[model samples]
Target: MYSSLLMILGALVVGYMIPVKHPSALLTIRRLSSWMLYLILFLMGYGLAFIDNLSQNIIQLFSQSAVLVSLLLTFNLSALYFVGRYLAMPAAEPIHKKAITSLRCLKNLRCLSRC
Candidate 1:
């Protein structure tokens, strides 16, 4: 575990040395990284196919996934609602008025799961 943490920290230090000099190149890299991340995740799912008890646990796996999805959806909607309510209050900070931020966050999550 410590080795993995040290490796990640080293990678982070190396990553900071690379410069995003152009907006277009930065945007391209961001899009490419997102796609690559999805590819990595899809590849990871292949391990699930080889599980010894997959046939028996398929339903349990799906049920747990459904439960997790419901919990996340509930939290997202609740946050959007409360944030909207907070924005309506007179004392709300100008920063809080970045209201579409929650929607964008949800969109990013949905893209990861669906795209």
Candidate 2:
């Protein structure tokens, strides 16, 4: 953890030192940053792959736990939305109308390919 923190601090310092006005310097930094991101992603994938290649029982347990947690989160959010709507019963109509108009405008813009 300390080493990771140090690495992050070093990256921040290096990133801060890069010039923004020079086009080639900016482009080179952007490319290098993207490569670093890809490398980090690859390392994470490699670690997860090792965990996945472990015994089937461990993998199954993790999968089941993940699904259960996701379902709980979904239900909790749905319940909260319903309760909030009920408590704010007077404001729902105006909010709903505003949301509908905004959505319609967004849809029309998409249809016209303006964005």
RMSD of 2: 11.2
Candidate 2: what lDDT? 0.79
Q: Write down the lDDT of every candidate, Cα atoms only.
A: 0.80, 0.79
lDDT of 1: 0.80
Per-residue C-alpha lDDT of model 2 across residues 1-115, encoded as one tens digit per residue: 5998799899899969865898898898889989998998998679767774467667786898999999999999999999998876564444543333656767687644433
lDDT of 1 by residue, 38-63 (tens): 98578669877788888899999899
Where does candidate 1 have its weakest 10-residue lDDT segment? 92-101
Error of 2 at 52 (Å): 7.3
Candidate 1: stretches off by over 4 Å: 1-21, 89-115
How many clashes in candidate 2? 0
